[model samples]
Target chain A: MRSLVQALGLALSDYRHEALFSACSVFVLAAVLAPLMVLLGVRNGVISAMTDRLLRDPRTLEIIPVGSGKYSPEWFRELAARPETAFVVPQTRSIAATISLTNPNRPNLGLNVTRIVATAPGDPLLERYGLPEAGFVRDEKSADPLYPAPLVIVSASVARKLAVPASPQELKDPAGYWLEGRVERVLQGRREAAGINLRVAAVLPPEALGVDAVFVPLEALAAAEDYRDGKNAPLFRALAAPRAEKRSEKAVTPENFEDYSASLYREREYASFRLYARSLDAVEPLWKWLAAREVEVYVKVEEIEAVKSLDHAFSVIFGLITGAALFGFAASTAGNALAGVRRKSRSLGLMRLLGFPGAGIVLFPVVQSLLTAFSGAMLADLLYLIVAFAIDSLFSASLPGKAAVCSLSPGQTLAVFAAVLAVSALSSVAAARQAADIEPSEVLRDV
Target chain B: MAAPAPIVLALRGLRKDRRTERAEHYSLSVPALDVRLGEKILISGPSGAGKSTFLDMAAMALKPDAADEFFFFPGARAGDGRACDIAAAWTRKDIERLAMWRKHIGYVLQTGGLLPFLSAEDNIRVPSKLLGLSAQKDKTARMAARLKISGLLKKFPAQLSVGERQRVAIARALAADPPLVLADEPLASLDPENARTVLDMFMDNIEDAGTTLIVVSHATDLMENMDFRRLILETGARDGKAFAVLKEGPG
Candidate 1:
């Protein structure tokens, strides 16, 4: 180790005398490679961030029952009990329900179209969509198993359409331009129903949901449409009770609506329900399990696969470019090393004449090559960091949510460093051989 | 009677072939030669008489044509030291042994083979450094002072005059205190005054260190007053063999 260090010191001293030339060589390499490094870093960072963002949305892992089938409440309970099932919320038949928004201060703004999505309070999509907590209080006297609040979360575009004030001061005032939400439903394709008013509980960022979608509690939509629980066979049959000749004049409230609407429907069926998997890995297994049961399933697995393929394609492209760059770097370094050997032939011969072992002297050129390559890699890394920071700073706001424009992971940095060192070391073989082959007789003959 | 000095280096029936594009030629043939411990011998020959080749063979830098029975015993303790056959050393592929052998036998080239990048002192210390010997600075300084090159130690090879460079080279040759020192025309580049001074210093230092010395030169006039043995080689072909003779005294 000490001898090796001494040889390295000698190499360094040799380089010190030719510092400018060495620096130029390093700079040439850095110039060729820095841009490539930045390109790969950006490619990896953007693609990974996009894939991660999509995967993080639990909705992407949803497997919906596509075709019509009878799914009992017991079946749903069993499915939900599985460790891989995060949540299994049944979809209501009122898929055509649209909501409109109005701000009292801007009455001139017309009703804007919005799609209504039904969700339970504990639905994972709520957290995935970054919605605030629903403030529903259960009444002790209420007999209903589920009583949903009238609150709704609107997309950012919807809030803008209603001209709702986004400032904290204005938002604190209950009367200051309260955004009015109204849900419109058609009953059995006959009469147009009056709109049910709802309060705007929160506004989601544009990235949270689709452009014009609004989220509401599932029970609220079911009650407004007088929809029965089709998954529950017993409940569906019990709801088919004969109607009395004289109907009760009292208005049906959310508190006791289940008893009043018992004789509405008989069929134990459902259009579909969202099936959430515990994780991305479980999504495929759960989909396969559900498909094996003869249930038609739809998932974002294709999209996930596409993202994976794109990532792989990018990696191959990056590998090709990096391979080419490394090849060029190796060739250039080898040429430089050969030239250096030719120039220092005398010195090498003198060392040999002094009884220095050829094996130890061979490390001279290799050490110099490694030092040059290491300096170049460090310079390129510095340049990459600067470029990444500049890009992130320049375009951070335009990026999706908090994603950076460019970044390099620790693993990627290490891989690049290793690759550069390996290339540099391998390239110096010819020069080392030349140095070792130098005979003390050559110096004698030359003198 | 005092005990006879043990033979430090001996060779018999040694031959070396020089090859070129056209044909092979015999470079050197020595019937017999021996140098005892602490002995100084001077070799004089015309050009192409294999003077340098003989020195190269002694330094183990060249391979001999014959493959058997050439001996070099390094240390003074004849009982403890073993004679290394030069033919076997030539055929062995282990470079470490060659390096070790070279470390024990110093060579001073015709023109000083000092690295241009190193100072005179550094050039002198190269062998010591190569051998990983510690505390060689004092020895190097003493050699430089003995060679009258102490003032030029800090200068690079290019900065020193021819005489100074030769003196530094001689200092470097003895830096490691090898048992055998070989010089090919050590005083050829110096003036008469510097040559005489360097010669006296070289004899004194080698005598003090008890080193066996072999000096090869073409200057016969320089060997007239010296008490060292003279080995003269006449270049000629004899009975299908090109050979040289080793005369015991000034011829």
Candidate 2:
């Protein structure tokens, strides 16, 4: 250890006058590495921000089955049995449906042609969109079996169109203004059922999908369209029955009707479904399972994975470029060391004559290289800080998350430091070899 | 009579060849030679007589062609009566052995080959530092005072005159108090008065330190007033072998 210290001291003493050269080497290394560090930092920050944004919104975890396909009651029951299933709700086929909303007190202001989105009770999306639990349970069951009152959650835009006052004073007077809802099938041009009234239980923020639509109970919408569980297939079948079969159905009393109803209705079918997993981990597996069954599945997992893959590819490309730059730095350092050895040949010979071993002399160049590399790495870190600050100030407002746009983590900084030291150590090999091979006799003769 | 002063250095059948592109010049062959403890020997030869080559071979700084034996005992008392075979030392090519040999022997070049970066005092202390010896400030100061270079100890080699540089070099060679000192044309780059003074001080210091000396030079007149052994090398007419002949006994 003492020998090593002496060698270091000697190297420093010899290089004291050549400070400018050392500084130049350090500057060149810093210039090469600072930009790469900034690039890596930006990639990490942007990707992490986007990923966090998706994870923050639980709706990204929803798995929807796409295309025209009936979800039978048995299929929903089976899906609900899975341990990872959170809430499985059946959705109505409301593709061409629209709703009209109006305040009874101010009929002049109305919401016309607003889209209708129907969801079942106990749906997890209600909580995700910040709806109160009471809103979901409101009007859960009605006394009359034939007709049920619909509970609606209107978006901010729909509420605004209806001229509903958002203040607490107006909210306390429920009788002051009543909102009415009427569902219409515009594409089919049909008006076969009575229009049902609805009361807005809550209003959603602009960020939610329901902001531009009116959310209502799926059963209520089905009743309004006279849409049965199986689209009234049994009624159509009964009406087309022969006269003898129809007379037999009329002979049964209402009290005894339950006995014959077992064979009355077929299984229900849905056009599509919205599946909510219990956690984020179940989304990918459930999507894959449904996709394998020839059902088109849509989720945010694919988009998140695409962004991550792009970030990884960017990192690899930046790493390759940085590696090339480091190689060039090493070559330049080795060249300088070789030249130094030639210039200081006489001093090295004198040390040899003084009984210093070749091993000791070799440490001279290695120590110098280490010092230079460490200094350059420190300089690069300072430069990185400045660059990161400038970038964050310029682009933070445009970024999504609260964090800065370009910031390096501590782990990344340490990795950069270790890499630079390794390259510098490798560069000193040739110079050390030359220093060891010097002959004191030849040098002394020349003197 | 007094046990003949144990042999400090002995060699038998030492030979070295100097080859050049134009011609084969200056090949040396020494049949046998021995130097007693505290003996001063002067080697006088012409320009191409291989005087410096012999000193280099003895110091283990250069390789010899072939030799039956070459040995260097540490001191006159000869610890364990063991001798180091110079030829064997060269064959191993071990850096540790070279360092050990250099620590026990001191070589003074013609122009005081001191590192230009280090001060005069640091140049003198280089041997001790490399060998990891204890503090030698007292010894350094005494040597500097004896060589009349006390004031120049803090100055670099380039800052000192030629004579002063030579004095510092001699001080450095003797700093470790080695058993043998080799001087190759130490007076070559000095005026007459400065050369005489430096030579007197060198001889006095060596005698006081009880160190053996081998001085190589072409000027025979420098040794006219001193009683010393004279080794002469001359090129033979037929075999082209330069043989070193001892002309006087040890003084």
Candidate 3:
């Protein structure tokens, strides 16, 4: 015990005795560790921010179309039957028609066409999109043009462009210059759009909308197109066929939807479908199952890197910057430490005479490196948090509600700290080799 | 009590050389030599007579360039009956034997070889520590008392005068209480009085321990007080041949 303590004390005292060597080691450690620590923080910040944003809108993980076409209704129904499957629904996307809402006194100005998407009532996508429930009654006396069986939610930009009145009485009164109508909710999509009220039912985050975009119930839209509501429009019914076993001879394809919709009077086979699973892991196997049925279906999965191009770019930039910083650190630190070790060769000679092993001399620089790196990492991580929070608060970016709450997990911190220490320790290997090369004979000679 | 067995150390026809003009060239040889236990032998010669070189060979720190046999009793022999022929051990496991041999046979260099970082006392304790001495305080105090370096214990080698540093070196040489001591012009840098003072201290401590001492010196006065055996080196016609003329000291 005494020997062990003595060895440690001697090692510690030896570090102090060689001031230049210790300083060089510590400087190198700090150099390598500071940028490495900063890189760790940057990775943590970007990953955490993306995760928070995606998680806040649960529908970010939905399998939306990358190209044309969608999954078969029968395939979707089969997937929905599985215990792991969470939710399954159909969606149709199209451009909203440019319709004129004229003002009698002023010259007409052209408005941008709105984007229209069809969805079901009480769908999981509504909450994921931050949309209020359907049937959010705006006014009782309103004879709104956009509502009846086919309800629509319009972008706030559209409402302002068409000069829609704020209330039912305002629209009805002579000053309103329009008939009373029920407003569903405001669409708060991020992209550009013109005002044309489809009756805003729920206001979404700005990222959700585009142009003069609107969301309408699938059934009502189908009914209106079929002219069922005393207007000339088409009607279509979404349906699913019985699940086909693997042994069956009827090969499923795009022609099937057309044939089935035409033949079946009561049920119209849907052209597209979306299959949901309990988690991301189940997606691959289910996709294979559909493929086995000879159904020409393509699948897509959601990862944070998918929609967040900015985050991926941030990661690459961070890595390059961190690497360059560490290189400068290793150069300056290792050079200084080696010089220090060479200067103290005589003192080291005395220690050798005092019964210290050749390996013990290396310990002096190694300990100093470890201490500096740990402290530097903690400092960098603290600075990262302060910067991330300050930016989020200042910009008021609908950046994601949880951006302020972003944080690195314990596993992440441990890995980064260990990596920095390993690099710093490696820088001392040259100094250790120099210390080991001392010849006691040289010390005894008259220098 | 039975007579204590005599430990004998000898050198015979020892030849050593250096490479001259990139060709191996033989330089000198001592034909025969012998010393019994507890006998002081002073080697005297003109400049370039290889006195220090010979001392190094005797101390086991250097190997002879050429030799028929070099032998030490109380040591194991090789198949050729030569102690020098035995393979040297340098590994950590054999370091104890190496250190023990080194501690017992001390070398006082011409220049003060005291470790610069250590004070006078720590330098004295070097061999003691190497020999695994735990009661360092007692050993240091005892050596300081004998060598009269008690007041200079805390002073570094640089701080001490030339004579004082040599005294510290002698104390270090005697630290392990070795059976033999070797000094190469130990008083070379000191004034006459300081040199004699150092010589007197060395003689008293070594006589009390009954340890054999070998001193290589230029001055005859340092050798007068003690009864010593002398080996004088005289060059011959051939480069490899040298005669060692032996003479008895005043008894």
The clash numbers for all candidates, in the given order, read 2, 0, 22
For residue A54, model 1's alpha carbon misses the true position, in angstroms, by 8.8
Give interface RMSD, per candidate: 2.3, 2.1, 4.6
The 0-to-1 C-alpha lDDT of every candidate, in the order given, reads 0.69, 0.69, 0.54
DockQ of each: 0.41, 0.39, 0.12
Give one digit per residue, the lDDT tens place, for model 3 in A1-447.
333334345555555545575565555455555555545554556555664455433454344433334445555567677765565554432312223233333335334344444555445556555555543223222344232332345555555565544343443343324212121211232222122223345534445544564555554333322322122222221112212222333332334533423332234344344444444445556556656755455444445346455555666776688678767665655654566556666655544433445555566455655555566556655665565566446643655444433345679768767766675567665776666455344443435
CAPRI-wise, candidate 2 is: acceptable
Candidate 1 ranges with C-alpha deviation above 4 Å: A1-6, A17-21, A45-152, A156-212, A216-271, A275-291, A297-319, A386-403, A437-439, A442-444, B20-24, B77-79, B190-197, B238-251
Off by over 4 Å in 2: A1-5, A17-63, A67-296, A299-320, A391-406, B75-80, B236-251
- Return the TM-scores of chain A for each candidate in numbered order: 0.62, 0.54, 0.50
Model 1 whole-model lDDT (C-alpha atoms):
0.69
Q: Per TM-score, what order, best first?
A: 1, 2, 3
Candidate 1 residues A18-95, lDDT tens each?
789889878976887688788777877776676666655675767777766666666676788888888776655545
Global lDDT for candidate 3? Answer: 0.54
Candidate 2 C-alpha error for residue A301, in Å: 11
